[model samples]
Structures are given as C-alpha cells and as structure tokens.
Target chain A: MCIEHKKEDIMKLVPLGDRVVIKQLVAEETTKSGIVLPGQAKEKPQQAEVIAVGPGGVIDGKEVTMQVKPGDKIIYSKYAGTEVKLEDEEYIIVKQGDILAVIE
Target chain B: MCIEHKKEDIMKLVPLGDRVVIKQLVAEETTKSGIVLPGQAKEKPQQAEVIAVGPGGVIDGKEVTMQVKPGDKIIYSKYAGTEVKLEDEEYIIVKQGDILAVIE
Candidate 1:
C-alpha cells in the first residue's frame, strides 16, 4: 500500500459525454510466471477500472452521450488517457472511443 | 528475433493521410536496476519510430495530409494504433492526431 492514506466517499462523479474517469488498480507484485517486475521495468497496465463514466463522445461535432457507467472494469490502450493526480490519488481522463474493451 | 526470415525490400512505403507507419523498438531485457520484466506483464511503450507518415488527417472531411514524414521518432498513446503483423514484422497504423510528441 502507498504511504498516503486511501480516501473513499466520492460524491461528485459526473463525467462529460463519452469521457470516463478511472481509478487505476494496483498491479500485482508477482507476474504470471511468479517473477516480480522491477520498479524501472514495470510498465503500467493500460487497463483500469472505471470509477466514473461519462456520456458518449461527441457525435457530429456535438456530444452524443455515453454507454458505460461507473464501476465498469475496462481495458484501454497503453497510450490512452491524460494522467491526473487529485489529492494524491491518480486518475485518468480518457475518451470513450479510446477504450478498446470492457472486461466482464 | 522472430523465427521467420527477415525480408528487406522496399517497393511501396506509403501511409494513408494522417496515418504513419512505425517499427516498434524492442523493449530492453533489463530494467534500470538490471531486472527483467516478465513476458506476461510486459507493457509496450506507447512510442514508435515513424516509418511513413500520411498527409494530415482529413480536414473538413477531406484529406489534409500530414506534418511529419517517414523517419521521425514519435511518442503516441499506448492505446493507439491497430496492430498488424506484416511478413513477420509487427507494425502499427495510427492517425497523426493520436501522436503525442515527436522524439528528438
């Protein structure tokens, strides 16, 4: 666990159309082969769990709305999202289309 | 190296408008601490060397062409690009807008 305390109780969880807010899950220490990844070599997974989902992305130059909601586990591209740190909590803002698949 | 024989022949190296071709660099075996990342947890960086660049993305629905051309090093979103395996070589095709920055 991080030295910083984990804070819960999110109220204002509204995402813009087609935009989604995700809280990254802490990656496991051991790999599938039971080997540990070094700090420098550890690549952050592109996948994240959806904390808040926005409406669908803009359509025809106008916001069309969204499909997924909050609490959805999604797999996104490794290169997607703009990093954001809110009160020591790291979050990512990404467009809906950027998400590739939803993990069931 | 992949088991397949490496083929090197240049006839057509064209990327569609706003699109670029890139050859992915192999991730190093060791980390900064000289530790290796497990294969299952290896996260590919969202960066690639521009092989062929298309014209700028379609402007107002028409192809606007591109700013960068072949042989440019670019950093893109990890989630970007549709992967393609061509003759034993993996290549990614992505729009110019998806590129984050050009590596100097």
Candidate 2:
C-alpha cells in the first residue's frame, strides 16, 4: 500500500509492507577548514527524513507494525535501500529493518 | 540489553536495543551447470539466521519493540551490518530495520 504525502512541490511516495521512503539529507559540500570537496569525493549521507511509511503487516506468520511515521528523521545503513527517481528527485525505498535509529 | 543463545559449539552474541546478531547463510560454491566458483567470486549472502536479539526500547522518545526473535531466518540488506569476530568465527550485528523479510 503506497501512502502519498505532499511536501511543498515534491511528490512524496509511501512505501508498503514494512517499507519506508526516504529523502536523503544533503551532505555539506565544504570542509570545516573551508576546503570545498568535489562531488565525487563526498560519500552518500546515511541520515534522511521519513517521507512516507508503510502499514506493517504479517511476514513469515509474524505480525509486524511500523515504528516510524512520516516526518521522522532517521539514520540508516549506508547501503540499505534501492534508489529510485521520482519527479526528477532521488529517493530510497528501504525496509523498516534497515533503519538504524530515529534521530531526535 | 544483550541476550545470549548457544547453537552447537558456536558462541552466539546478543545485540543491543533493536540490534540483532546474525550468522550469514552460505552461498552456493558451484553453478547450476556444475561449474565451481572461487571463494572470492562469490558474493556475500544476504540471508541469515537470527541467533540473538536485543530488547526493543525507547529511541528518541518513541517506544520501539523488536519484531523479530531468535531462530527466524531473514533476508537483509547486503551491506547492512557491522562485521565482527568472536571465537574465531565471523558474525554480523545489524539493527532490526535492516532486515527485509523473514523467510518461512
């Protein structure tokens, strides 16, 4: 089940079945010492904001419910999700289990 | 909190918070047509068996409980967990969200 949410002009996508759609937080382009890093030199950020949530359902006969919702900021494994493009924007679709923590 | 379980002679490790300790499943050493593949040619398996689990607790004011427990076979993100060694054996520690599906 996909859940859609609107954030400004961005078309938010909702994930299904213990899945979450995340918009990655942008990394700083400049170093603390003021040197600007090239795009290729920067690693993908693990931090993201939860844009959509899936309704947790049963898997392998076990009932699972989502622990996160839209608008929650989260930290996830670096290579967790499948990258997708929507509305000319990049997003990630990750299982709930791939999320490491919810950032306060 | 960490929970320990023993399987055969293996010293199992329990994870903390939403963490899970997993033993990765071995991949096939040969192809379906009978060609043997070298160890380095094989990709790390994504499927694993749960050996230990941590008590789900509050994170960022949210009460989170674990949806998985010991003995559940699961599929997770390929690069999801941190690799660790114990008793000369390799294991992985992954947060619950890294798990994709529990295999029946």
For candidate 1, write residues B1-104 as lDDT tens digits: 66876557734457766677887655456767989864335656554678877765555565443555678765565677887777776789887656644444
Candidate 2 Cα errors over 4 Å, as ranges: A1-10, A31-40, B1-17, B20-80, B83-104
Residue A31 C-alpha lDDT in model 1? 78
Best candidate per DockQ, number? Answer: 2
lDDT of residue B19 for candidate 1:
74
State the local distance difference test value for candidate 1: 0.64
* Worst-scoring 10-residue span by lDDT in model 1 chain B: B38-47
Worst ten in a row by lDDT for model 2 chain A? A38-47
Q: For model 1, how does the per-residue alpha-carbon lDDT over A4-100 read when each residue is reduced to its tens digit?
A: 7655853233444456777776666777989976443467776688877654443334545575667888888777776644334667777777888
| Residue B9 shift from truth in candidate 2, angstroms | 46
Q: By summed lDDT, which 10 consecutive residues of candidate 2 chain B come out lowest?
A: B1-10
